[model samples]
Target: MQKSYEEILEEFSENLKVLRKKQGLSQEFVAGIELSVRNYQKIEAAISTPSLRTILIIADGLGIHPRELFDIPSLKNRPMVKEITTRNRKSAKKKTTKK
Candidate 1:
């Protein structure tokens, strides 16, 4: 079945939030890609839909392919992505602290 528009938006928001946090980045940093902090916040909050250009800029800022932002296979997919992101963040923190 096709996902609803709202579902896609919500998934995108969750994915963006997880990806940003996993990189230990601030909203301001992602906002600098091509938008204001308020706009970026709206995007992550699912309050506003982003244009393809904005998505590309965000993907570039996050250092990931744009496709990753929309790769949800199912509703259950988000939690798995979030779990991996959390683990990656923890591992990165450990590496940083070790230095």
Candidate 2:
């Protein structure tokens, strides 16, 4: 299923946080790359959507490919996504059992 814009943003936020933590970097450091700390906080919190340019800037600061920020395994398999899939499967099972 196609993810909603909000979902995509949420995924990006979570992924960015994880990646930044993995690199042992602080928000202040990441934000120093062409963004104010408040703006970076908004992006990381999913309170604001970032443009492609901003994404690239952040990736550059993190020393990673911009695509890596969005296409990470953790983002793709987020807990909410898995939970929804599990619920759908259970509902389908119930329907089949009813028939």
RMSD list, candidates in order:
13.3, 8.4
lDDT of 1 by residue, 31-86 (tens): 78478899999999999999999999888888899988987655554566689999
Off by over 4 Å in 1: 75-99
Cα lDDT listed for each candidate: 0.87, 0.87
TM-score of 2: 0.69
Candidate 2 lDDT: 0.87
TM-score of each: 0.69, 0.69
Model 1, residue 25: distance off in Å is 0.6
Each model's backbone clash number: 0, 0
Clashes by residue pair, model 1: none
